[model samples]
Target: MNWPQSFIKPKYLSLTYLLSLFLTLFFLSCEINYDGDERLLVTGRILNENNLPIPNQDVEFWIYKGSGAGGDDDLISLTATDNNGQFLMLIPSPNNEDGFELKISDPDTIYQHKILHRILDKNFTNYEYNIGDIVLYQHHVITNAYITFNKTTVNTSLMDVKFKGDADYLVWINEPETYYGDYEPTLAHDYYKNVPLNSTLTITYTIRDNSTETLSTHEATVTINNENLEYIINY
Candidate 1:
């Protein structure tokens, strides 16, 4: 008598599961890396509050537990970022996976940790997915930090500014329309979060001098401490 093709014996399934467990442990012990274009490749960049790369930080990938059928939350792989604060996770996509999570953490109390939840729209699109940029805020806080851009020349056309992270009325990438020249403290665009404390914010702005009819490029830096420190930009 022969069994059905799709029918898996309970004992056989247990053995296969055990074997996979052994393999996962062995691979992790040897090298926290897996390679191949066919595998599911997840990548991201890790940065500090000041928008600086964080190297050698711990990163992990976990698959959620499937309902009634699959096992518990499966930790597929573990790895760390390179000198450039970049990480790559290559693993075989499991069967019937609802979603997954990418966890970034530090064992040493240097930087605060983060967990990113990703839900698949039916399934993944490409072999590679990039999570653009991630900022891990270090342990600290700035009670009152602000920025004031003063117009040096009269009749200035427009002003634009950028920061290493979010602010009251500023987004790291683009300027919010509601924020004319003042920020009330909020968040937006490209991984928005509360202002990072005790960090140096780099500001690059383009101010058009109407009288000169030329664009001026300027750079400035301001360090935020316990007091009300303002990043004054004279454009």
Candidate 2:
């Protein structure tokens, strides 16, 4: 049984050609991406100061290009938290020199806005990033006031308090009308009352010594809105 060399060579060459074609197609399939850039997954939860989940809040992702003089932010994705205060977002792969910023805000005006600057570094390609829990503080119209006295103070009792604003505007204080200090001035007093949003609040207080002598008089003004406010008075 003798086979011709010419026939064997043709069959071997044909098999080699078919094998090369199959390998080329397999590699091409592996490298092709039909959906464009690779996607990066991000997950997080939103909570309030009370440690309760905040649902239905808007979460935003911003991508920036360049730096300093020519940098600009581009809104990439917008998503909302679920009932459990959880959110997931898919971000496309960024360039080697791009930056990322994340922001979340309550739509019901109950919590203050929160912003996380530069959460993602540059050249963060297709990868998952977990931000865990982000807590927002409650918005308050009133500010808490703490008053302290220096070692040279004689009297430590508030005698008179005055509010200068519209006559129709009502000023309220959660603490006692008059605060009397013993050895140390009360530093944890909540005297400032909440005012209507977007209003100007001015408070004046007179403190006297134990012998009925006026120790000091002080005044402070703040523009009240949806942000947290705290005032400290050192006599």
When superposed on Cα atoms, how far off is each prediction in RMSD? 14.3, 20.6
Off by over 4 Å in 1: 1-38, 66-71, 121-123, 142-195, 198-235
Error of 1 at 79 (Å): 0.4
lDDT tens string, model 1, 8-77? 4665567788899888875544432333434787888998756899999899987764434324567898
Best by lDDT: 1
Residue 44 of candidate 1: its Cα lDDT?
84
Which residue ranges in model 2 land beyond 4 Å of their true spot?
Answer: 1-35, 67-69, 122-126, 141-235
TM-score leader? 1
Compared with the true structure, all predictions reach lDDT values of: 0.62, 0.61
Model 2 has an lDDT value of: 0.61
Task: Give the per-residue Cα lDDT of candidate 1 at 116.
Answer: 72
